[model samples]
Target: MSSRKFSIVSGFFLQDDQVHATPATIGALPPRFGLVDDSPECWSKFKSRIAELNDNASSGTTYKVFFLGRHGQGWHNVAEAKYGTRAWDDYYSKLYGDSEMTWGPDPLLTALGVQQAETARTAWLKEIPNGMPTPQRCFASPLHRALSTWQITFASDESFPQVMRKVMILENLREEHGVHTCDMRDSRSLIERNFPPPTYGFELGFTEEDAVWQADVRETKDHIKGRAQSVLDRIFDDTEETYISITAHGGIINGILAAVGRPSYSLPTGGVLPLVIRGDDV
Candidate 1:
């Protein structure tokens, strides 16, 4: 892979204290979707600004906008909530789930999760008319929850056709891998059965079964950040899409944000964060 680094570009988004202080929840588009200045055509202006940045960028450098979306409430989320973070991390996460639910080896979304995804879909529908650029490309974690979230949010509607909204599943985008059954993804064949190709595509070298996940070894945050950087570098090197979307887990998205030097902010289930970043070959 090419040696590349990324940095957050402020001034375009309302990532200022005021907006970041607010709770980022499902369907809660940051005040005017975090536009630095409010206007009827704010999104259009923002799009133009991105184009200008790329057009003026020196060779080996490019600017792109990323929409980082967290998957809706999975059974694991509910399990963690019920069990509390400490207990869940120590005990519950290792097992499949409690008696009431099963969240392991890629659990499906809970009902609330589905509702949250629908809310995300509605949010996108409301913004498109406001000049929000439909994502030129969409990427998702191999995990089922993230895949389902992407399907509901971007691919469910006829307004966004499949040709325009192709989703690529990336293994590196999966949540901090290992130990937690919730982090373990299902077999690729199973995933393909549900989210079949023509619309859903897997990254090159994707394996048939879970390859990186190991039940005994949990990945460190530093390792997750490194993985995030690797995937970002791959995307920057291979794709020309200016507007991109990634549906992934909280830890994975957090690593992505941190890798780009953005402030840390927790996204509620189904929540989305928009960031503008510049990548330079080192």
Candidate 2:
């Protein structure tokens, strides 16, 4: 086999476990990251061909993504009520009653919520073709609810290797013109003030509210979107065929999808959304 002996600009020598290169080496190296001189036909031709392959793959390759999930049920759901106006709190108290409004640090899934997660898992498993590349990466929000969902879905499956990453909280997923928070149990006026005109639900509405909860309650949509996008960018940058699985809050998923120009899709407690990121996008 014929081999070219051109120097790399900067690269890891796995045998030595160290990085190497100088300005001189960089100047003589192939243009772009992770390139090596294994072929000598015009570099431009190789690059162009690779670009074409990437576009074709992105458009045609069906990426398999499994969304492990966490229900939004948490203690904060009730604590936020106390901060609302007395009238609002009274209305909420009547609605939910004293059924232990908030969950503890590691809350158990509600009956209906558990069903949601299981349904999501079953649906994803059915969609993925057998013997496809196992999930290349798995990420989850730091919250227990989300973590638990991930554990339940992939903990026993050897196919998916899992890792946890901090992501923007859910409250930041709203449209710029929408409200930030609302008393899910009460206060029609507060709901109107905090949420968008087309509400999601009436029984436990205010899934999109941002009242006077806390200064830190609000995360800039732009910032959160950037962080989520960065996660995707890094994954795509690293490999030509990386399949990423992110187990995160609904909002974080929505933010990342939005950044990629997809319509906002809600991630149920254990829903999965598979995305194929083309190498060219990196």
Candidate 3:
């Protein structure tokens, strides 16, 4: 980790009025103070401070040299609007068999989602073509909305689109699990068939069956934070990239920020935030 070349992939200060982060350049995210990831001394200091900052009854996402993205709008967004978050969380699947909820266990992006992703695609095109770094690697949650958004945001039709070949599906990157019907994913078998091998690679290390999804379980702040930490550790330890992109959900992004002691931020559907891991931080 110490020797890895660190850089950024997009993002702004937590207080920004807007969701999208500015393009990669010095002086981006004006209000953000102190390189969030500095060195080992700073990392220890940050952990102690985060341990204190995390005193609220409810707990926290942060990342470095990473592109954090939320899945675009989904059928679940519409359902939640009609039914509200509480009931939609509690009874949508049982009452409507998921058709009225997020369309199914693994929700797909809506037309609006595709439109939102296209908007994101426009941003990425400008950024990537204008000297911003393209991802050295890419990862997406197995959920349809996430995978779909990944496809739209990163896909290129040029003669050599090798980056597409490099994308991998990371089950750990999926959103908070099992609380809402829309969050429950499709069967692993179906997922594997849909995502396929190294060509459309699903990480081989992922398990065949979901380990979570208990009827009574809802991912707590601690749960999410731990998951965020675990995922970040895996990425930083294993990746060859100085830059990366994660197509996942708002909750996971939130968790990541909090866990890493960075200022908490929000990323709406198709929203993208860029972060850097200064070489000093591990």
Candidate 4:
């Protein structure tokens, strides 16, 4: 990493009545000991020593993350069930009437879902002071449903500023249960026939068939964890005092929690999970 020096105003260092001692009289020091009289070589050596001192001065810095979950009631369960039933064809015909149902994007949240998000915002704001500094960075999934949930939950909150919000179209956080690009145009029968078992039976010698299915889920989860890690790495590497808020799906949030070694943590709809990451702790 390249090293650079920048001046920063340190409020903690300001001289005030709170400080117990008087300022030291550097000008009263012996003339031979003055900082200006030091040679270039000596000054360079002194700077290096100060850098080392600073590094050893204290414990590592800590970063805090807050995760916001989207609302409940997705269409996937109903859609998948319809696909498995004989009523599938008739259901679609009746449901769409003259129009055709589109499968490309996920369905929007229900009215109850919107209420859930609003409830969460109201609950959260009740605890945190409105004047408290908001998170320095906010990230949200690109999907309309997730993005909508984020907007409705935080946009109305007095604590969250619109300028801090940013959307990240992370493919890694996309649902892993659906058909991929390769099977997009395939017939329903063909896709259904290729669907793998829900659970892996390890006693089966890790067969190629089993491997493929396991790889699909594992790779998706791994990618989600990697993306979460990348977000954290960027924030910490910059050494900025940024509190982070990430709005994503349940699966992706689960993956992040698992990556952080909290696999038991489950975030409910519109729930916020706060995490503190410390350099020394990590």
* Candidate models: Cα lDDT each: 0.85, 0.40, 0.63, 0.42
Best by TM-score: 1
Clash-forming residue pairs, model 4: none
Ranking by lDDT: 1, 3, 4, 2
Candidate 1 — what's its lDDT? Answer: 0.85
How many steric overlaps does candidate 3 have? 14
Q: Write the per-residue lDDT of candidate 2 for residues 31-150, one digit (tens) a residue.
A: 321134334443354335434644565432322222324344344334444546465434442333336554333234455555555565554454333322344455544334554455
lDDT tens per residue, model 3, 121-188: 77665444333456678888888788888777666434224774357887778888765666777767
Query: Candidate 1: which stretches are off by over 4 Å?
Result: 16-28
Q: Candidate 1 lDDT, tens digit per residue, 1-282?
A: 786889888777655342444544323466555666678888888888888999999999999888888899999999999999999999999999778999997989999999988988888888788888888889999999999999988888989755546799999999998999999888989999999997899988899999888989999988988999998998898888888899998899889877887656777888887878789999
Lowest summed lDDT across 10 adjacent residues in model 3 is found at: 26-35
By summed lDDT, the worst window of 10 consecutive residues in model 2 runs over: 8-17
Model 1: number of backbone collisions: 0
Q: CA RMSD for every model?
A: 1.9, 18.9, 9.8, 19.5
* lDDT score of residue 130 within candidate 3: 31
- Candidate 3 local Cα displacement, residue 60, angstroms: 25
Estimate the TM-score for candidate 2. Answer: 0.47
